[model samples]
Target: MPPTKLAFFRYLLIDEMLRSRSRPFPTKEEILEACNEKFGVNSISTIEKDMAAMRLDFDAPIYYDKRQKGYAYQDPEYKFLSVNLSEDEMLALSFVETLLGEFRNMPIFSLFSVAVDKVLDGLELTKKLHTEKRHLQQAIQIEQAPYLKGSDKLGDLLRYIAEQKVIEVSYQKYGSESTKDYLVHPYLLKEFRNMWYLIGYHEASGEVRTFGIDRITQVLPQEKDFLPQEKVNFDAESFYFYCIGVTALSEKPAEIRLRFEPFLANYVKAQPLHHTQEIIEDDEQKGCLLRLRLIINHELKMLILGYGAGVCVEAPASLAAEIRREFEKGVAQYATKN
Candidate 1:
């Protein structure tokens, strides 16, 4: 029979006792007393049966030492949960732990460190070996924005999301001197370009709105309960389906076609701008034509602008004109004085 939750916990306790360096081997009576204290009272016969199960089922190298007058592992290094990881896999795990360093300053993901440490401990990676593997962090650095604002609000917002609470927020938009109050039923917390945003149902507007976390001055106490999920009807996937970045300004998505220079086309093919992105045409002389169905927002515009002269918007004459105007403005700026 498979072990019950209580049975598994008893097995763990027994394993710890067997592996104890200072106490060494422990008597059946001692093991029973410890298990009984934690779980319900278990008899000495139960301990014997548990050890037998450990030996048979788990292949635990458990034996009774006559000299010590107690039960012990024949293999001192034996663990109930043995995790065998390849050297490469171990290094990858270490690299993942290092990647989490991006959120080290954020309190919301603090448990991630503890969880990774537990896995490393289970793998029995020596301190020196683990430290050496961590050198990969220095070799492959993850770029993180220094001193991100509103990071401290992550923990509280996460808690509110879990509890399904409605919150009142004091917000000030960029370049706006005035601060406004909002009653929001926060649904999802999204991150884009190292900045955080709260996607929620705005009670006053009776529609969904996106609020930048950095712009939020305060989250007031819960004056009202959250609206029913059915009433809110917020589907994060559907909401973001046609959207690029945080803003979903339009109800319908535009079919955007773009042409990239040959060299830049290779990079775009490898790392696509959107999930709906498709290579419509590619040629040695003509370059590449890419198609994307997306809502043309500030982020998409900025991304296209970042590519400079390498990319050209082919379809959507309005968007193409907008890009042309932007480029013309840039050229005009350069034509004049600095």
Candidate 2:
């Protein structure tokens, strides 16, 4: 039979079986009547042939119950339609699996794996089909950050933040010898380039701070609640808009400008460095200059260095000087030692 005719027959046969579900026993005439009006067919031979074909193709356990003199599903667990995949679906499944496999240690990987399994199971795909499609090619690529090292303390900080609990943490601030004890109301957890940070409101200091998770030597959950004064009206995106890196200092943002080489200009243009990034000057011949109103922080400096000679900071004299000092320090490392 042609594809269209086969499809029509399958639709009618399935419809008849579904209608029989609620009833104790439905006669062939009744099943035929329900489908014949919709399909414009009344031949018993045609109906029988379609039902037999459906049973064979779908592997459905449908049979005629002799005592009831009506057709019934032999296996109660079997569904009318197998959630089997077409070629396209199998290819999509295979591609996603490969991409997820790259991030094997990520917390979300197991959840994604379980979800893929559920979808495949629903489609009635055999293990062979799944295995055969594993080699399917993936076009898009995502580069995940290197696995975090020396930060077993991050998991605990993340748990406290998720639970909305106050934590007493011992943090060694950069350049500070003494470890400061803080009663912080955890606001958010951030991971930037493998380094993790907890953004919270420090009660004793009466200030919002970003504490690197790696610097946290100890984390103790405090029973005392540390709710913000006005329920932290800060929107996370807007608050982090002009951050030098992940540390969005509680200072007014400045209009910071940076120049990029022609080759790197297009790459920067395609992706925004900050929520408020905009192109102030773009001359392919002279290179491109982009402006963003964000804090000048170490995180942003590292990002600029990642592009090496392709990018430069054109900013507050202080920021430019800092970059120069960093390059000089790096150069000093290569000098001959007496």
Candidate 3:
């Protein structure tokens, strides 16, 4: 069956559960009638399975009362509840819903949109909870991020990737003046910092590489046969274990040491820079020394620079030199007195 139809059916079951919470318990026949009114069809088998799932999966206290000739709660006060949606879950979904607002008209997520709305309806949140969600959504607009023009192509790209097929991708790398087209073997998609990246085996390079979805101008199907990804052997899990962001790769990780000003010591203690960060030394006058085992890359450079004078690279002299050079260049730009 179509996924949307199944989603609507689930909605009908939730409606029936909540509707039963009222007086005058509803008969199975009445439940079917209500579902038919909204969706033009109903099935005894499907409804039976939904009821069973509700009981087994969610511990709903539903039972058939022969005296009322209807389905009612075995325990009168036992409310039919959706255990899936706690406050935080709803908030996360609301954020995703808002993020997806930019592409609501895209057919790729039409069924997904219906499913998300159905899940929200099933939650049956209180007015106060709903209001809190609305207020949080208003605090920031996730849809206002840099527009990714060919985002709608993600669904099709995913489909081709799942089938281990090749695709003609028109991708323009960062800082490039022109777009480049290539036959890429779609392998995996990754997301970081609210942006998506495609990890594909470039037919041109014979190696797996990362491409930002935002920079992909087009993804078209290839007439060539599917490429077996087993030979590529790129493990997505470990590929990014020692990296930040989705840019250049390093040959190997290094032990990076940094010292934070005494004033900012507590802040770094509470929120360390990386997972490998460790407090190796602490001094009131000399600042706190922390260590991290990761590649020195563009992201790490920007992160250290953002801390300004509060942080300094104490070890890995090369990394320190790189940061110092950038700072010097930055100072030179303002030295002109623009």
Which model scores highest in lDDT?
Answer: 1
Tens digits of lDDT, candidate 1, 1-338? 34587788889999999999889889998999998898875789999989998999899999999999998989877778877778787777877887777787876776787777787777677574468656876688778767668878877888888888999889999999999999989888998888899988898889889999999989975868788556877787788888779998745899999999999999999999999999999997778999999998888999999999999999899899999999999999999985
Off by over 4 Å in 1: 1-3, 16-26, 37-42, 65-69, 72-78, 126-129, 220-223
Lowest-sum lDDT 10-residue window in model 1 = 125-134
The per-prediction CA RMSD against the true structure, in angstroms, equals: 2.8, 10.1, 7.5
Write down the lDDT of every candidate, Cα atoms only. 0.86, 0.72, 0.75
Query: What TM-score do all the candidates reach, one by one?
Result: 0.87, 0.62, 0.66
Residues 301-322, candidate 2: write the lDDT tens digits.
Answer: 8887778778787886777788
Q: Write the per-residue lDDT of candidate 3 for residues 180-268, one digit (tens) a residue.
A: 99888887787666577888878778778888888998888888876666777776677778887766474798889989999888899
**Candidate 2 overall lDDT versus native:** 0.72
Structure candidate 2, residue pairs in collision = 83-123, 84-123, 242-294
Worst 10 residues of 3 by lDDT: 14-23
lDDT for 68 in candidate 1 is 92
